[model samples]
Target: MSDPLDKATSKAPATLGEGCLSRYDPDDLSSEDGTEFPGAAELWEQLQDTSDSPEEQASAAAQGRH
Candidate 1:
């Protein structure tokens, strides 16, 4: 795997603050905690439509963007 901090990466570093931290919490989606998981359908609907290339599409799909 490529190290994200390596200069060769075309990726950006984490820029999100506390508000965006909710997306990473394992308990955030548990029904017992009074929240719902954003299932595949909800996830697909919420993704941005920016890339049309096959590679980009595959990457997005792998990341649950579709």
Candidate 2:
């Protein structure tokens, strides 16, 4: 309790899976984990709407190759 460095230390939540698939377990998360993202779906939809389709992007790239 007297060590100032110990007060600055933090720990991460438990994870599941391994390697690229590893992620924090949802069941172990709480409000303190900062997992809430109310705007995530809206942001995803906005991004999807603004981005070009794969076919359009491929065609644009093909034109530059000529």
Candidate 3:
């Protein structure tokens, strides 16, 4: 068995936020390059499949009665 203090020290240190890995001083940074991805929201909405066809939905309803 390990001591409580030893077990605590064996684990890694925690950061401030869930998604953040390291601290950032935004004032020290500058941006470069000009690559762009446009219409991302429109493309995502178009790609989603919300409903099935009328025939498929009707067939599914019929099968579920069993």
Per-model TM against the reference: 0.24, 0.62, 0.23
Candidate closest to the true structure, highest TM-score: 2
**lDDT (CA) for every model shown?**
0.58, 0.83, 0.52
Candidate 1 accuracy as lDDT: 0.58
- Prediction 2 TM-score vs. true: 0.62
lDDT of 1 by residue, 9-62 (tens): 343333434764534455333455545556867667556454367888898889
- Stretches of candidate 2 above 4 Å error? 1-8, 53-66
* Ranking of candidates on TM-score, top first: 2, 1, 3
lDDT of 3 by residue, 1-66 (tens): 776787563433333444555744444433432223478777775654235567776777798921
Give the runs in model 1 whose Cα sits over 4 Å from its true position: 1-51
Q: What digit string (tens of lDDT, one per residue) describes model 2 on residues 1-66?
A: 497867776668899999999999999999998999999999997886559687876876798831
Clashing pairs in 3: none
Q: RMSD of candidate 3 to the true fold?
A: 12.9
Ranking by lDDT: 2, 1, 3
